[model samples]
Target: MSASSSRPSYAAVLRLSHARRTFGAALLGRLSYGTVSLAMMLAVNRATGSYVVAGTVMALFGVMSVLLSPARAALVDRYGPRRALGPMAMSYASLLAVLAAVSWRPGAPVALVAGAAVAAGACTPPLGPTMRAVWGEVVRDKALLQRAYGLDGVAEEVLFVSGPLVVGGLLRFAPPAAGVALSAVLVASGTLAFVSSPVVRGVRPTPAVKSARRPRGGRALLQPVVVAGGVGLSLGAVDLLVVAFAEQRHHGDDVVAWVLAALSAGSALGGLLNGAFEWRTNARVRLPLLAAGLGLALAAAGLAPGLLALTVAVACAGLFVAPALTTAYLIADESAPPGFRTQAGAWVNTAVNAGGSAGAATVGLLVTHAPLGLCFALAGTVALLAAAVPAGSRMPTPTTA
Candidate 1:
């Protein structure tokens, strides 16, 4: 095939009937995922009148989701997303609805609400990872396949950037229970449709390839996966640092909004533009450089003279965000064993979350005692450490043509 055959425009990728259908359904499935936490915390706090109780529920949810993600993805690996998505979507949504109702009732037990929240998280459909897994099947061209991964990273960032605002805004006019109910409905219906799509229905899990020559033990997560998560941890730290910076200046939420928006816009642009050009750099070399670049950017953010300068610095740093993330996905997909592709994707998700937790905890504890720059430095240092992990490890190359 000609090289041109491998590189379709974004419009072309979405224009394929199957691709179009799949994207639409996936969008709905995702609409609530990023926002659900806000919804849950609000309802729980309102019902319990205690931040401690609310926080506990949210923490448990996070823990359950991380622990269960691999198993859920493995189910998709064995049964196909078509079968796996439904039970998860329905069960998760139903559990959320029950939680919302419990929160609404004045006398509902806190433990009951917590249990439902835990179940909802454990039941999260492998929507994001599965979509990425299927793209390998849908797009035949290696170049286009790479681009698709970039696009998926950008889409996921969109959720992170917008999810809180959307959930918060809706919660303003509606009750917390209403917000959660809506979230449940959206995730359920969207995932249902996503699984029902002809294109999605046809995608099967990657079968484990066999080779006695290849060394094997317990697999999926390894050094590369840790580095992949480091990307998230670093970002999460920078995120909180930006908020602290804004608070330090007494600029409040408005400034914080500007700071995050700049980062978001830069990341979106970088992801779109990166795929347009192929790099001469090897994946091993490219991955670490991009990750370390984030550290440098975080440092720059700390050094900016003022708010305007910080915004510019953050946007510059944001430019590297998507490229680094895209590389992480490429690494995970390339590094894992065959039967473990879906499970590998789950590991990446776990790493990111685990990293975020570490970042948030470390920064939250230290930010009050140290200078904002110190916190930023800590975040930068963590990312650099993450970069080294992958640099020291071995990752097999692309198996594709």
Candidate 2:
């Protein structure tokens, strides 16, 4: 495929008025949450002059967020985004203020900052799932939802990359207090804007959970959400591979950032192009093919003879990343019984997080003994499995109807 052959058409997706406002607010406001871990670490390390304390504090915050997300998402599923997320965002914003104020002091109390982080993480609105749910309500069209999810996948990638960069910049030029404060403002403001958007408020839960049906309750191996997360597991190895490759080659920090950024940039573009097309293919069929593509591309990345080859390979692999994720959401949302969409979304998030964490650990250990290509090979192999996971399994046509 030529370079110019894949440009995405963003017109149709962005044409919807409701999606425009909600997506814009959510994406912009999300930067604070996205950047918080790094910014908080930078703040604490700068203020207390200790990386140990900084790491510990952020670790508590992250672990709690990952652990608490499901329950919070369940709540949103139960009460709806407006009632659940609005209050949660406000309280989160308040706590962030306190955290920022306290962390700025000469010797901030460890317990207090930790407590604030815990509170914020536990109450943090499950917006990732919420947004997908909202898109269904506002767009009310299957094709558009695919586009929405595609845009969403791109936003997620961008958030992860830009969040750290934003914090890094603040740490270099601005005070840690400023970064924390800005994050608080962003969180509060974003939540309010998103929750208040007509699209989000209009979201209605699928009928009751009692009426909803799925294979093996929500934990089935063949479930779309589960398979999607397996993709996350495979892709997680991509980052570790990039870092390891950069280090093995003795590239500097700039190259490290650029290499990682390449994956995200590629994913962003792929998502755009993927969403642009209205495919005739079934979701189940598409899922595995995309996963296979991702796996093979990543494998090629590992085998690249040089930096240029690796860049092209990584970019090629990224082309499938967001589409795979969007398809997972499509399947999961379809598979979710009436009224359980939010919980299903949370589960997807959980599976991805858990899988990614585990893959990173495994890759890190193996990198010490194996060639970098071996890591890529492992990722590709797992991705192939992820593809097979839903191939013959019980699956309905992915649809909101």
Candidate 3:
């Protein structure tokens, strides 16, 4: 066959275009969310005169997001990306504005802040799952999708690392209100850009089959969908542990940036490698290896006696990060019913976030009572345990319904 004949057909071109648009939307959504999160932390901290209070507010935001994320995902599955993305973006912006106003007032009521946090959480755009579903539609090749995920992972790391620094600087040099206003601007700019994209504009919700009914009990938990959620939770916990370890070691301020950078860098490398491979491996092999590697790295980091050793160890831990996550993504994709693809993706994200929250809470307590090394060891052990979960169970069957 001629090279041209082997090349992606005209259909592939259209798909690529759609993928590009979806990626743009995802990037913008992440940027906006990151900015708001950073600014909110600073604003709350300044207003309450306590980091603990600020953290509580942040925790509330997480809880709200986790609780509502499934519903938002369902909305996307039911109503399509356009309908879900636009309204959620607007709501998020409005919430941020309200939060800013509340912060601007001296001694603003705690109840008011708490209420806004809940609202903000509930309004979070279902970007991760929605974008994943969009990508699935646009990218016909599995390898290409993996690359896209790697890029997405990198973008998230950049956003989180940079967002806080920007907010911190604004809070220090400009008024606290300035940071809040800047956050609002970021959200509006990013979210609006995403909603207006042609790809998003063209998306239509798939029609649900009228004969389909939800699956029953224990069988449901064993489904690939549930397993994917579990994987997400594990990943989230790893993230939280990283932060907690940094804080305990007096490296909290800069360590987050470094650790995330390392992980993103590793994931980017993995993506490139994934694209090069023409063959596939079983999750059975991939998950355990990645998890074991990560576990060892974290344990090594905990045992490190100096900053240099700690940095090296963390970077090593990051080496397996992408492969493990990609495995979870693939599992979820293969397992979900067509209409629930978006929701499945969101569930994975929610699990990760919830797991991270739990890890943070656990490490916070451990740091106070135990050695920092122990905290790191605990994270590694949990990751190792996560590796075992998939091994003991039968591989999830692909959904046909």
Candidate 4:
């Protein structure tokens, strides 16, 4: 592949035919993912009057969502997104509506609520994976693809940060169930719009095309999956650890939210800046260094003497988060067998969610028993070890399907 005469701007990525319309619709659908968890948790807690039951229900939802993701994406790989995504979005939306109705009033049956949640999770659309697949299909230039991925990553960061706030605003005049219903509308409508795009409809399934110079089999995915898991693990630990730190210092719980917001701000900035440059090294070489940088920043966050210092340290850690995840996605895209790009991306998604769940559970238990600094160190060590995982050899000739 030959380099372009000049760097491709992110605006150029959007200027591609149908890029804005397709990407906008996909983001609208993906925002449902950002909002659903908080809405469902709140609805479940209100109905059950027991935090334990709510937590258990959420755990079941999350587990099903994470475990079935690759299978859902495989459907997209096998049948093309136009055929595969519509049914998934509709089914997921219907189930969410059912969940909202069941939890609208107190004394809802626990079995019914739990069953509805599980069903909804199983049907959740593979919009994120499908969108990345679309990006790969529409954007031929590697540099422009990098910008597209970076833009996507930064927008996702903003969505997650704003999602809970959206729920909070809804609670002012409506029940949490209303938020759930709104999520259903967002996915169904957005997906309907997404599949209607001419570019999206043109993405047909293709058989795997082998390249001898590229690494074969699932082994190629090992580094990105492991490193993504490490990033997720450290991030999961950060929430609880930050709260604990705030409490220990006699600060209000609200401080935790502000600190986390700082982290997101840094991530958005990092992603934008990362996308704006052209690097001599490929993603395989850049990924491990990004992971190590995150690990070091997190480890140092533990030693901050004041809230301001801790926030700054966390923000620095945030600098690596989006770029690392973007690089992981790029690697996944490059490593995917010709027909399996959606599944390849989904595998990384699963690893991140599973690792986050494990990290939260493990750190929740350890935070009570260990020193704060030790807990932070332990969390950071997971990423450091993952960074040490050799990134494997560079592709002699990188190829995209």
TM-score of each: 0.91, 0.88, 0.82, 0.95
User: lDDT values of the candidates?
Assistant: 0.77, 0.75, 0.64, 0.87
Model 1 alpha-carbon miss at residue 339, Å: 1.8
Please name the candidate that would achieve the greatest lDDT relative to the true structure: 4
Q: Best-fitting candidate, measured by TM-score?
A: 4
Give one digit per residue, the lDDT tens place, for model 3 in 1-401: 01121233333332465455556657766766666777777778776677888889988887898878878887887788777767887787788788888887458777787788778888888776777676666555665565555556545656766777777777667757566667666656666776677766766776555332334211232333333333344445456556666665677566776776676566556644543444467654565666667777777787877666766777776666656665565556555565666776776677666766676666656666777777777777777766666433443322322
lDDT string for model 1 (123-188, tens) is: 988788788777765676756766777777788778877787887888778778777888899889
TM-score of 2: 0.88
Model 3, CA-based lDDT: 0.64
- Candidate 2 residue-wise lDDT, 218-308, digit = tens: 4332555556666778777877888888888888767767776788888899898888887999987888899889888887887898888
TM-score of 3: 0.82
Give residue 45's lDDT in candidate 2 (0 to 100). 76
lDDT of 2 at 286: 89
Off by over 4 Å in 1: 1-6, 105-107, 206-223, 390-401
Q: Which stretches of candidate 4 lie over 4 Å from their true place?
A: 1-7, 209-215, 393-401
Clash pairs, candidate 3, are 232-352
